[model samples]
Target: MKRRPRRSVPALLTALVLLATCVLLAVSAIQLILGERPWISYDTVAATLHDLRWTDVLPAVAGGVLALAGLVLLLAAVLPGAATVLPVDGSFHSGVARGSYRSTLQAAAAGVDGVSGARVKLRSRRLKVRVDTTRTRPDGLADAVRAAVTDRLDRIGPATRPAVAVRVRDPRRTS
Candidate 1:
């Protein structure tokens, strides 16, 4: 059985705090039972609550912050991110990482005639290819990149076919 990962920081801090509180309460109870002076008195706590000030508000603010922190930790523990896997052509599905696919697409795009370099972003249903040319601004650069990337995608055989959108960037502007 696969075990889910837990958020340890919040849990550990909460446990430590509760343990300290229990120990303090136990000590106070023992002091009272032994007819000794207790660390905290009920009358002082009541007086503080009745005459609340900024210092009293600090505890409430701290509690609120702790609650928010615990809530975020709980959500993170419960809802984990989905694994990104690209299905390739074969009897057994090959898991391709997102970065690997982007790199493959970039290499394919850069192989085009006038392209000096390429940047590829592979989304769920869209492939954005940005190609940079040194000085040669050839016509149909977008079409060339689209075709090359499309052919590569077909060979890769991802589960879903992403629409290839090509954008050509000319770093040095020529008249």
Candidate 2:
């Protein structure tokens, strides 16, 4: 089963906005019912709305902003979030956290003979490994790192195996 990241941020922001609007409307209604000064003046609002014309720039801009906001909210609500955990092959109930997965790959790459330091990035379906070595002629080091990382990935057996790309750089070279 694919695990998706939580959409709590957008959901929370939308809820807060709606709650504030509802509270403001309810307070204004209560003030009107009690014959007190409303938080928002209905007469002024009515006059402004009545005077607004379709050709006015203010109304057109406001409408456009509202439409764009609605579109963004709709897309956020409907679209699926990124995966938080990758599924394990041959296991329906188990998955690996992306952090741990990357760590494992980094360890595997770093364990190679000439690698002094290693960094791994897993994005979408790509696994990028950058290794630094003290050796000036780091010939075939990239292939070695790639082979080691690939072997570790095979042992882990993730449902969707990412393509591994390895880069070897000398520590003394700035480029």
Candidate 3:
């Protein structure tokens, strides 16, 4: 299977690139804001840079090169295919579909009486259910949710195995 990046990864990478750009900009800003020469003194630069010539300058040059490389990398991210957020199992859209399905299940679960919030997560087709429910567990709320989901799955036919998890996020009595 071909490897692919997650959809959010680009956004994340873009953010990282933005952050890198900000850092570079900050460095440039500092360079511009304070144009002071190196405190090493002109004599030091002349003395130190004179004898070794390019050799002594090599280290500083290398450091500058590295910084430039990092800047290039940040710039490359904007160009596409520079860095990809790999998806789990190389199937990003599948994961997104699963996520959306889980969200639907959660909403359905929340509709049950006594339930405040339902957060459902799917692990390889299995449903990990976390429901914020009021006192009494509302009796069989989990079952109801499970049945609804199973029915939907039957109609839709997911290509992966399914598991169900039910948890009570909160249990409180409400009039």
Candidate 4:
């Protein structure tokens, strides 16, 4: 069975906007057909919509649409072209479980302060998460990464010390 596509904030908001747009257009058409004077300003339109019991509806629909657009923009900014399944030089025979574990690591890495992005690559039971951070110098970054990853692992489950590797992959690019 094919899984249904998960509705993201943007997609959902777009749908709501479309529905609300249809309703507004319909209302406008109806008013035009009935020979009502056109509303001059948003205030008048809002007042009319309020009288027609659509005041709350308009705001709610507009807000949801705006919020969804913001979320989509944020995702695009944070992780552009991120693959659903990571394809790197790695071997995790445990299949899906291993992939999930690696994702967890990546999330943990991302949670660290100053870390812009991180990629947790698991291969042959070895784990490596390269941190793309704004650290000006290569001091205490390794320790900080280790501590963050360890804390996250402790919360995840039984503490099995995986071979933890962390390196600052993205330094401040002068160019």
Q: Which candidate has the top score in TM-score?
A: 2
Off by over 4 Å in 1: 1-56, 78-82, 172-175
Output the TM-score of candidate 1.
Answer: 0.62
- Whichever of 3 and 4 has more lDDT, that candidate is 4
Would you give me the overall lDDT of model 2?
0.90
User: How many residue pairs clash in model 1?
Assistant: 0
Q: What is the lDDT of residue 116 in candidate 1?
A: 89
State the weakest 10-residue window (summed lDDT) of model 2: 166-175
lDDT of 4 by residue, 33-143 (tens): 787854334467778766764456776888898898788767754653423333232243211245576788789888888888888877544578898877676577777
Write candidate 3's Cα lDDT for 20-66 as tens digits: 97886677567656985433344665786566755476877888988
Local error of candidate 2 at residue 93 (angstroms): 3.6
All candidates in order of TM-score, best leading: 2, 1, 3, 4
Q: Give the TM-score of candidate 4.
A: 0.40
Give me the runs in candidate 3 sitting further than 4 Å from their true place.
1-98, 169-175
- Please report the candidate that would top lDDT against the real structure: 2
Q: What overall lDDT goes with each candidate model?
A: 0.79, 0.90, 0.61, 0.67
Give the per-residue lDDT digits (tens) of candidate 1, residues 8-108.
66678778999999998899889889999889776787897778775676778988998997788778667854335566666874667767778888889
Between candidates 1 and 4, which one is better according to TM-score?
1
